[model samples]
Each structure stands twice: as C-alpha cells, then as structure tokens.
Target chain A: MFVDFLYELRERGVKVGPQEALTLSQALGKGLHETTLDGFYRVARALCVHREEDLDAFDRAFAHHFRGVPDDALKIAEEVLQWLLDPRSRRELTDEEREILEKLDLEEVRKRLRERLAEQNERHDRGNRWVGTGGTSPHGRGGTHPSGIRVGEGETGGRGAMAISARRRFRDLRSDVTLDTRQIEVALRRLRAYVREGAQDELDLPGTIDATARSAGELEIKLRAPRRSNLRVLLLLDVGGSMDPHSEVCERLFSAAKRATHFKELRTLYFHNCVYGRVYENGSLTRGPRIVDLLRECDRSWKLIVVGDALMAPWELTASNSPWSWTEEDRASGIAWLVALTGHFERSIWLNPEPEAAWYGTAEVIRQVFPMFRLTLDGLTAGIQHLLRGGERSR
Target chain B: MDFARFRGTDAYLTSPELESAVNCALALERPLLVRGEPGTGKTQLAEALARALGLSLIHWPVKSTTKAQDGLYVYDTVQRLYDSRFGDGDVRDIRRYIKLGPLGEAFAARDRRVVLIDEVDKADLEFPNDLLHELDRMRFRVAETGDEVVARERPVVIITSNAEKELPDAFLRRCVFHYIEFPDRELMARIVRVHHPDLGNQLLDQTLGAFYQLRDVQGLRKRPSTSELIDWIAVLRRAGVESVELDDSLPFLGALLKREQDLLAFAEAMHRGRRPRA
Candidate 1:
C-alpha cells in the first residue's frame, strides 16, 4: 500500500525515490505519526516533499491514496460496524425509530458516521445525540442536521478527505506560474564574473608549500587576495506611462538587481518614456544627474542594462526639438543619446517588457542601436551571457 | 541518554506542523532544513529546540566566504610556521596547531548538542554538498594530524535558509524540510502577547489591522515581517500612544517599513484611499 502511494506521488510529478520512501518508513517505524492518518500526512509530506511548489501534487496524491476515512478514525470504523450490527442495540428501538432504522442501508453506511457512532455510545433515540435514527445527530440516516454527514450514503465517502487536500494552500508558491524576485535573482546570478582583486589576506597554501620546498629547510608563507566578482552593473529603468502595465515585472527585476550581491557595484537610474538629457536617481524623478556627466563618470567596463517597452511617438526618438526634451543644452535626439550610451559601454542590452509579438515602431528602431531581449528568464539569461562573452566590444 | 521532545520554549511558539517536523527530524537523526521569509524566527527555532530538549546549542553561522572545511577544522599553518621559527616548544607535533571548528567540536563533545548551521544558503552553492559525507557518517578526518574524529553522540542538526539561493537536490533530499508560514492574526497576537503582556486588545487590533493593510499595499520592495511588527508595537508603547485608528495614518510607520520606497508607497497608497498600482 505504501509503495503504491509512493508511485502515486511519483506519477503526480513529485520527485520521490526509494531513499525518501525509506525515510518515511523509518519515521513510521519510530511511531512518529502516532498511528493517526493526519500524523502520517504530515510525516509523509515532510519526508517526501522538499520544495514548497511540490506540495499541491503531494496533497493530490495523499487524497487519492487515503480516500475519505478520517486519519484518526480508521480503526474505529470496524469496531463501530460491529456495534451497529448488534441486534441487542436495535431491540430497544421504538416502532417509529425502527421504521427510520429500516430506511438505512446497513452495508452502505459512511465511515464518518461509524466513527461518530463509536464516539457516542449511548443510543439517544431522540434529541440530537447518539447514532440512533433521530433528531439532528450528524451520524445515522434520516437526521435533519444541516450539512451533516449522512450515514447509509456510499457516494459521499471521499468528501471528508478531499476537503483537506482541496484547500491547496500553497498554490501561490508555485514558481512556474509566476516570476518572483527570487527567480529573477537566481537568473541574475549568471552575471557574476569573479576576478581576484582585494587585500592579500587569504592563504595561498599551494604557493606557500612550493616556495618552502624550493627554499630547502626554510619556512615560507604566501598570501593572495580572494576572488571577487568585479562586475559593475548600471541599470536604467523606464517608469510610468505605457510601462505601468509591466511595472510588476520591472519592479521584480529592479529589486532583484538592487539586492544582487554578485556584482562589485550596482547603480540604478529611472527615466520616463525615453532617455535623452538626464535620468532620475529616484523613482519619482525630482532630481537627477545630467546624461553627459553620467556617461563620462561611468566607463566601458560597466555593463549597461536598459529596461523599457520602447513604445513611444516617433518624434521622441528622432526630433531634437521634441516637447519632451527638458533643456536647450540637450540638443541630441533620444536615439542619439541611446546610441552614444550604448557605444560607450563595452557590453549593453535593452530588455523590452513588451512581448516579441508586439514589438514594432520605436521598439524596432531601438533594437537597431542596441540588442533588445524580452524581459524573461530566458531573455535575462541570454542577455547575461552576452555581457559575459568577450566577442562584443560595443553594439 | 533520554531527551524530552521539543514542545517550544517559553518565549517561542511553534505551530503543530513545525513541532512535528522537529520531532521527526529528531527521531530520524536527519538535519531539519528550515526555509522562510526573513524575520520569521528561523534562527530562533534552533535555540528554542535546544532549550526545550535541554541540550547545549552550538551555532555555526555561515558567511559567503565560509567553506565546509572551516566547519570541520582549520590547520594553523601560519601559527606553526611562527612557532617553529621563534618558540622553544617543539613544532613537530601538528596536533598542537590543529583547531577544531564548530561541527568538529559538536562531534567530539561528550554530550549530544543541537548544532545550527544558520543561513547555509549564504555560502556557496557547493557548501552543503561538501559536508554531506561528514553529516551522513557523523565523522570527519583531520588531515594535518591524520586522525579521524567520530561523534560520541549524533548532534541534532538544524539548517536555516532565507531562500536566497536554491540548495542542491542531493543535500535537500537527505534532510527533513519545513517552510514556516507567516503567522496568521491569531498566532501573531499570541506571539505579540509574549513580548507585550500589558498591551490592550484594542491597540493590538488597530496596529495589526494597519500592519496587514500596509503589507497588502502593492509594489512594496520589502514587506514588514513579524520582527518589524513587534518593533512597531514597542515604539507605539514607548510613545504612550493610546488608541491607533485603522483608518488614520500609523503612528510609527518607520518602525514597520524599513525601505524608503516602501514608506513612500505606503503613504501614496493611504493618500489615494486605494492600493497603489505596481
């Protein structure tokens, strides 16, 4: 039975094996489950399911395996069936009670009713107590209690156990359905490029041993700086306007980049529809550093990432005297500035939140100046690989 | 030696599921891998279990630079080099310079202990994999002295992770896993009462209402967790604020929302009388 249950879990896509099964059996042997079905559920889940997303699958498997018997009342069913079969208990029934008892199919009684009958020993023929055909007791047939488990019913046996697994409390935790910040963070980890550059603190054991052996009877020590990822990231985010619909994914990406420890330095700046003259340091766009100064400050070593939909009026990217340009000194068009920025950075990529099927107009124009990839797990991974590769000096 | 089951210490409260997970790990002698949101008392679970079981706690806090060998032992080659050059004592004995780490100490101890590998995910991805052999066998070898140190009694191991990184499958498969859910209102109230015994029900209700509402606000970079809620209550009581209204602005918003963006988002959300768009 346990092996069948294990196969059921495996069939439902939970990654369980013989080792997990052995652990479950060992836990059961120790009497950890206390011989209760609910206890077994907890123990089996803890032993078999290691990931939170796999919980729903585990629940489905459990419900299918156990059916409707209450975890703690599996033993009581047999004992209660015997008590219900006893003719001595039925002998005390009144004529009206015997009529109600005759209506119940003795062989088709539900497990829950039997368990409840085991709990209530005294047969109270009337008044909401005991399993006798009567007034509002959940057990026994011909009772008028609302939503109570009706005895002598065969089809509703699975409802009790099904309700427990049907809750599916962990549905939100499933990673395949949503792109959370943690998943983005994991994708961002591929951007790490480790280069040993720091204070010489870590012991170079192999170097020390080699030096000592060469010196012959002389003690020598070697120290080298620990390897640290020297990757510097400059994230430019386009906020507000058409980007509002994609803000959730963009925020996840922004937060993931901000929290990522792989890079030696990470700087974030926000822009509106397009980048031309300046970019705001804060999301509200009150104050910002000039684009020219920022370009001069950041060298080619920094990998530049621009996140935007790139869907805007054509004039915004082409015309220098467009209404969106804030200052007279900002003479270059939006595309010109983007080209200059992309040209200055050794590695640069633009992430478009808009799906590939929707890309056209300004998005197509932007793709010409910079390599554009969708803002997805695969897209981010591909963009990171592009940044890591040594072939491209500039787009 | 017999040990009592961990029911939870006076200051800590565990749900039935978490309590059972702890007991199952104890019975099977497998490491309990605990993952949860930050400030959900992941580290405190280990301390609570040790206290409840009447065992001494041995904490090995893992950092990004931490290696598996660092948990077992560290051969003090520099110290030996210095001693050979300047000290009168013989430096030929490598045992003098060999130092046992937290895991090594736990193995060599006379009594069973609760060993906590806190934030194991903070280290490299291979960190857990490196300790698989020692953890499975409860023994390690000190290569410097060529001596094998085995456990007198297997220590109860509890590993915690913030889900910063995904742990390897092999390491996860060998352990009992539990994800500590964020406490609901009732459990949160009980936990708060443990810290603030004198707090009134009205104040608790208003603060919790506002706190949960703030968490529900969209586009928050970081949500305020249980520890922040406790701190917010502490700040409220310190200022002698009697009645906090759920409709009104919170008294000590800084105590709950740590990030600047979150505070701004909360204010914008409250000002609009609706949840802010992401």
Candidate 2:
C-alpha cells in the first residue's frame, strides 16, 4: 500500500527514493499504524516531500492512490454541468418583485425563510414561499431574493441575492491579480529620505584601496555604509467595494512598501469607501482595532500617504449620521477626521488611484483634505518631492 | 518522540497541532515547513524544538541570492587556483577546498541533529525546487571530491518562510505544515508572564492592552512583536519605572514601535485623549 503511494508521489514529480520509502514503511508499522488519514497524510508528506511546491502534486497523487477515482458529483463542476444542461429551466424574477423583496428587512427575511423551511413538504419550483428553484423564495437557488441564505447552488448572477445570511467562504472578490513589484519598487524608491542614520559597517572598496595605497600598503581599510533613509511612511490603503478593480495595483504598492529597506519606518492601514471614525489593519476589517486609537498614539513626524480612488458617496465623507456608523448619536464627518490627520502630519498627500482629471469631478470632501496625486510612478515622484519640500499646499 | 516532556518549557509555547506535526515530521524523517508573518516565532520554533529534542541545531540562514547547493557545500575553486599558481601548497586534494555547509554538516553528523533553514522565502524561486531530491534522500554529491555525503542519522529539518513569495508546491508536499497565528491578547499575556514572571498583573494587563491598541493601528506596516515586547519590558525594568504610566513609557516607544510613522501616530493619539487607559 505504501509502495503504491510512493509510486504515485514519484509519478507526480515528488522525487521520493528508496531510503524515504523504507522510512515510510517503518513509520507505518510503528507510529502510523492506527493513525487517522490526516496523521497518515502528515507522515507520508514528511517522508516523500521536501519542497512546498510539490505539495499540491503529492495531495493529488495521494488522493488518487488512496481514494480511487474522484466522484465528479462531489465537485462544483458537476453542478455547473447540470446547470448548463438545464439552462432553459431557470426563470428570471421580475424587476418590481425584486424591488419589493429588496425592501424586506434582513431579520424578517431570515424569519420567513425559517418558517417556510419548516412547512415545506417537497422539492419546490417557481414557488414564492418554500425553499426551492426559480422563485421569490429566499432559501434556494435558480431564484431571486433581495437578501438570502442561498443554499445548495452556485451564484448565477449578482441579482440572485442581495445579502448572504449564512457563513460562507466567498470567492476572494478582491481579484488579487498581481503586477510586477519591481516597477512599484522603482516608483517607491523616490520616496526615500537619503540621510545616514545607522552604524557604518558597510565596506568602502574604492576608499579602502586608496587608503591602503596611501598608507604604504599597511592594509588599512576604510568602511562607509550607504546613508540610511530617514523617511517614515504611513500608508492608508482603501480596499473593498469600488477598490476591488484596483486590488492588483494596490497589492503591488503594498508589497513594494513592505519590501523597501530604504524607508526607516513604513506603516499601512486599510479603509473602505471613506475614513469614518475608525480605520482597520485587515483588508476585510471585520474584526480589528480602530485606526483612530493608533492615530492618537502616532509620532506626528511620519509622512502620511493616503491611497484611494476618492470616489465615494458624499454621505461617507460628510454625513455625521451615515449608514456606515453603528451608533445613533451624530459623529464628526470623515472629512473632519481627515482634516485633523492632515494637520497632525507635517507632510502628507493623497495618492488617488483615479486620474488627476477625475479628481475635480469626484467628492468635494476628498478635494478639501489634502493635495491629491495620481497613483503613477511620476505622480509618486511628484508627491514625494512635495513631501520633501515640507509645506502645507493650498487645499 | 514524547512531546509531553517539553510542555513545561518557559522559553516557548507549543500548540497541540504543532506538537503532532513535529512528531510526525521527526518520525517520518521529513522536514517540517513553518509559515507565518514576521516575528511570529517560526524561526524560534526550530530552536525550541531542537532544544526540546536534545539535538544539535545546524542553522542555514538563506538570502535572496542563496542557492540550494550553497547550503550543502561550497567549493573554493578560486582559492585552489590561487594556491596552485602562486604557492607550493598542495592543491591536488580537492577535499581540502570543499567546505561542508550547514546542510552538509547536519548530514555528516553521526548523531541525530536538527537543521534550521531560516527564511527560505528569501531565496530565489529555484532554491526550494533544487533541494527536492537532496532533502528527500538526506544526501548530496560533492562535485569537488566526487563523493556522496549521506546522513549518518537523518537530521530533523525545520524550514521557515515569511510567505514573501509563493513557494513551489513540490517542496511544500514533503513537509508537515504549521502556521503560527498572531498571538491574541490573552495568549500574549501568557507569553509575557512566561518571560517576565515577577511582573505585576496590573502592569502586564495595562501593557498588553496598550500593545494591542498600538498593533490595531491600521497603517502600521510592522507592529510590535513578542521579542519587541520583551525588549520594551526589559528596557522598562532597567529604567526602574514601577507605576507603568503611559507618559513614562513614551521615550521607550522606540523599542515597542520601530516605525517613525507608528511612533508619530501613537504620539498624536496620546495627545488626542484617546490614549490607552492607565
């Protein structure tokens, strides 16, 4: 059994050998005899694998060797195939019905869904109440609902559901498509503050040669490290919603910032739509500490870089009692907070993902806060230069 | 094989999954692959496991330009050429120029040893793939000496990555994987207690709350890690400040938050009356 598994791994380009096979056999006889599949997987992986790249191959091979032919019905591909075959059966919900459904509160929809499920007798079709297909039901697939717990079907269209009720592992809506970090790295290079601040341990080859010659070949070597950049950058990246299209570029920027050793200090934060009373560390920002707390604790000397499209509903930037806020009490507008941030940081700029021409027509609050620059290499260079010059620009 | 024996160690904490993974890796003579964010103790786990298992650790820190072969052996061809041309020294024996690297040393050790490949992600993409065969067989061919150096006793290998680059899937398959998640407030408190036993609960609690608050800052690229926390506490202890006041710890913020931006933002927050509770 182990030999067949080893054969499978080798076929998958795992590079397993006799010694590894021998060890595996011994392991199976001892520690792995009564272990669970996960334990077996761990042991087998350890014995046969050496590189992380081969993990997927090994997994495929192991599944093939142990589990036999994979059942297509267990996969989403099967469901997709079925959906394609029965394409004519799917019914589209009317616009008026969708509008009415959209007005239903999420809690009320959930309650109605539960009641419908309890009363349901059989598989339903084009029904309004029971959990089934092609209906105004908020429970099943091939149907439309303003807000729903879409059970047992893949998403066909955006209109199929307004809100997801059940916990789900949604496809990473942020494309995560990548751009070459090298270009971003080059752009970020301009943002350095070239000032020597650290220990001089770097060897000066030319100086060492000259000094050695000057000292009558006494072997005296001179050391000089490149002046460390004292530039401290605080980047607040906008994520989610409209920013989804720009994820790849944003990621490239994030990666470049993280990789750049020139900056003495670089920090990053995430926000969605607009900066409210808080900012978050994670992209989803479902559960993270408030950004305002950290802002209050900031050093004030750090250069602030706010990266976002600056195209959001005016309410997000100016309304004290916006929908985004969890509290009933009126809070200060996002513009107020941003204004405070600009005042706090001596040198700061907003790097707009959108073009320079677009900013004039975008939200007025965005224009009111800081000098907005396009998110290009040239724009970055210009922004950094503005920061280096160190004065408040006309807002 | 008995992980239970090392449970009481104050230097490091091991989760059940990690304990199992380590044991499995050891039993199967496979390298363990650890992935985590920076400062999550991926490298420390290797050191701790080595100490716990009573094995001599052989460390091979990787750089971006590092090759897989550099971990096994490095042939001093230039030195040999220099010796042969200029000196009367014997350069015919190639073994003299063949310096065994960390991996080679681990393999050559007669007793069981632990090999730590730290920051494997820093290496070029090919590095992990190139080591696939050598690591699987626990042997490598020294081209200079025309000898195959095999492990006398299979050395336990622990490979850590910061996930800087997506590692080759083949390399990932050969190892038991573990991700050390960022320590929560309670877990961090426990970790702090382990490091500083004499610290008062009130002081530790206050410090942890502030640390979490600081870490929660949205824009911080690098938050204060455990080691930094330890350093901060040590600095505080050295300064002999007993009351654990936020104002007193201002000067030592450099130890906790290295980024100038983080330091500035922290100062702004402190002045803005949103400071952590005393």
On lDDT, the candidate that comes out on top is 1
TM-score of chain A of 1: 0.62
Model 1 chain A worst lDDT run, 10 consecutive residues: A160-169
Candidate 1 per-residue C-alpha lDDT over A282-375 given as tens digits, one digit per residue, 9 for 90 to 100:
8899888988989888888899999999999999999997675678998789999999899888889999888788789999999999899888
Taking the tens digit of each residue's C-alpha lDDT, what string does model 2 give over A129-195?
3233322212233333322212223223223332321211021111112325654665676776666
lDDT of 2 at A167: 14
Q: Quickly count the clashes in candidate 2.
A: 39
> Cα deviation in Å at residue A339, candidate 2?
45
List, in the given order, the native-contact fraction of each candidate: 0.61, 0.20
- Chain A TM-score of each candidate structure, as shown: 0.62, 0.47
How many residue pairs collide in each prediction?
0, 39
- Over B38-115, each residue of candidate 2 has an lDDT whose tens digit, in order, gives 787888888898888788898899998799888899987656655654665788888889988999999988998889
Instruction: For candidate 1, give the lDDT of residue A388.
Output: 77
